[model samples]
Target: MRTLIIIPAYNEEGSIAQVIGDIREHAPEVDIVVVNDGSKDRTEAIARDAGAEVITMPFNVGIGGGMQTGYLYAYQNGYDAAVQMDADGQHRAADLPKLLAAIPYSDLVIGSRYVEQTAYRSSATRRVGILFFSKLVSFVTRQRFTDTTSGFRAANRKVIALYANYYPSDYPEVESIVYLKRRGCRLAEVPVEMRSREAGRSSITPLKSVYYMLKVTLSVLMSASRVRVRGVKTSG
Candidate 1:
């Protein structure tokens, strides 16, 4: 199957090269597409040097916008599957096969921290918010989710088309899960270990984290009321 590993980068020069190189080594055949989202640094150059087919947006469009571009590219190129991976070093390339294996049977496969066992460590406050989001997903989708904030995920053509057509503009990680589920898209998770960022401070500072959680929760809760999920299946 044609697979695209879409890396959304924003001022991620420090870790972009490493992330791309690791993916190339582990999944050499998988097409790497780096969406350089208005980075002020050399993120695009580094990604290019690492052999990723780069897409440079004129300005920083944030995570959701960058990801949508990837989806659009996948749809246009006729790719069968696409993986959303963060440019930060937190996500591992080694766990890609499990995600790929599940994508054929499931519309979406999330690289989860608590699927089979908990192997992730983060701040306590962050954990609380994540747990809350997990419960919220379960409530909305009628399926228990282990990780709602994970960016490491793989989606088949159907899910890719959905995102390309209509994607949440801001804070999409949790909202997209609800959107996919409403469409009757099957979802699964694989246990994957996450690492600390190799560089850069997170957008979610302690003070900002509180506000982000509140804002995201309300937005998702409101959007869920209007979402419509289509049952996507392969034509035989």
Candidate 2:
């Protein structure tokens, strides 16, 4: 398959190059694209020097917009599949193949850290948020998901077109799964070990974490009842 790895970065210069290098070393057959979300640092330059295509947004559009940009690019450029990974080096490039391997059986495959429990660990606050969202989504979608907030995912052409047309504005990971499930898209999760961030810190602060929990909860509930949008046109 013509696979593209999409890394949405916001001032991730600290680890962008290393992330690109890891992808190239582990999944050289796939193409890479770095969505620089109006970063004020050298993220774009570093990603370019690392030999990945760069897509720069005018301003910080946040993860949702940046990710949608990558999916839209993949859809328009005739990529058969697309994988979403973090730019902060938490996600392992070695897991890319595992995600892609499951694409043939699923419309969207999520690389989860909690499917069978590996070395991945999180803070108490973050764990509560993750568990809450996971349970919320599993209840609404009638499918168990251990890592609903996981950004590490691979999507086939069908999901590519769907997301290109309509993606959530922010904190989209959890709600997106419910959105896809509501549309009858098949989803699967594979166990993957995630490393701690090599540089920089998480964007989520304490206050934002509270807001994230509430906002994402509402989004998931609403997404479950919303009608599926029409798929956008894609070229060969």
Candidate 3:
């Protein structure tokens, strides 16, 4: 498949190069593009130097906007598949092939760490959030999801076009799945190991954790109430 890896970064200069290098080393055949979300650091230059296409936003548009930009690029440039990964080195490039390989069978493939449990550990608070969102989405969509908050995912042209037009603006990972499911998209998850960030810090702090859960919960509920698209053929 002709795949484009989209890495949305915000002030991730500390680990951008290493992330790019890991992709090149593991998934050498696919192309990569880094969406610099108005980063104040050298993320753009370092990503360019590391040999990946860089799309710099005028200002901080957050992860949703940055990802929409990358999906727009992939849709316009005619990429068969697009993969979203983090620039903080938490997502593994070695799992790229597994994601892309599942593209033929599903409209969207998520790289999940909890599908089978492979040495991936998180804080108690984060785990609770993940579990809560997972159960919520599964109940809403009537489909099982082990990791609803995972950013690592691969999308076929159908999903690329959908995401290009509309994506959740904040904390998109959990809500986006419900959006696609309502539109009759096939979604699957594959087990993958994730690493702790080697640089930079998480945007969600202890204080923000409560807000994140509340906001995402509302978003998922709202997304679930939207009318389902009729006769949407997502199968390849």
Candidate 4:
């Protein structure tokens, strides 16, 4: 199947080239697209020079908007599947094949850091939030998810079309799991190891993480409460 690797970058000039290079070295067959989310740095130029198609947004629209743009591109261009990855070097390129391999049996496949009990450790505060959301999502979806906030994910054509039309604009990864569960989309997880960021600081501070937890929890609850209507159509 034709797959597009969507790398959403925001001021990732320090790491974009290396990330793109890794993807090329590891998953050379899959097409790559870097959605530059209004970065103030030279991220776009670096990605373009590295031979990945670059899509620049007018302003910083967050990860959700950047990913939606990629889904739309994939949908329109007839890609059978698309993978959402980070340009910060946290997500390993070697795991792309595992994600793609799982796509045949599931509508969505997530690269989970905690699935096999790896050495990947987060801050205490972040781990608490991850555990909370993992339980909450498991309860709501009736399926256990070890990593609810993992951005390393792959989606098939149906999901790509669905997300292109109606993706959450903020804190989307967690909320998106609930959304897909509501629609009866099959989900799967694979064990993958992630590295610490090679460059650039995370946007989520300690205080912001608290607010993120509260807001995303509320969003997931609201999403779960909605009734699933049948016959929803999406452009292929």
Off by over 4 Å in 2: 198-200, 228-236
Instruction: Write down the lDDT of every candidate, Cα atoms only.
Output: 0.87, 0.91, 0.92, 0.91
Cα displacement (angstroms), candidate 1, residue 14, comes to 1.0
lDDT digits (tens) for residues 60-101 of candidate 1: 898889999999999999999999998887888998998999
For each candidate, how many residue pairs have backbone atoms clashing (under 3 Å)? 1, 0, 0, 0
- As a TM-score, model 4 comes out at 0.96
Per-residue CA lDDT of candidate 3, range 94-198, in tens?
Answer: 898889889999999999999995888777887888999999999999999999999999999999999999998888999999999989999999999999654
- Candidate with more favorable, higher TM-score: 1 or 3: 3
C-alpha lDDT (0 to 100) for residue 92 of candidate 4: 92
Output the better candidate (1/2) by TM-score.
Answer: 2
Clashing residue pairs for model 3: none
Please tell me which model should have the higher lDDT, number 1 or number 3. 3
Where does candidate 1 have its weakest 10-residue lDDT segment?
Answer: 227-236
Off by over 4 Å in 3: 198-200, 233-236
- Winner of 3 and 4 under lDDT: 3
- Sum up the clashes in candidate 1: 1
Better of 3 and 4 by TM-score: 3
lDDT of 1 at 85: 91
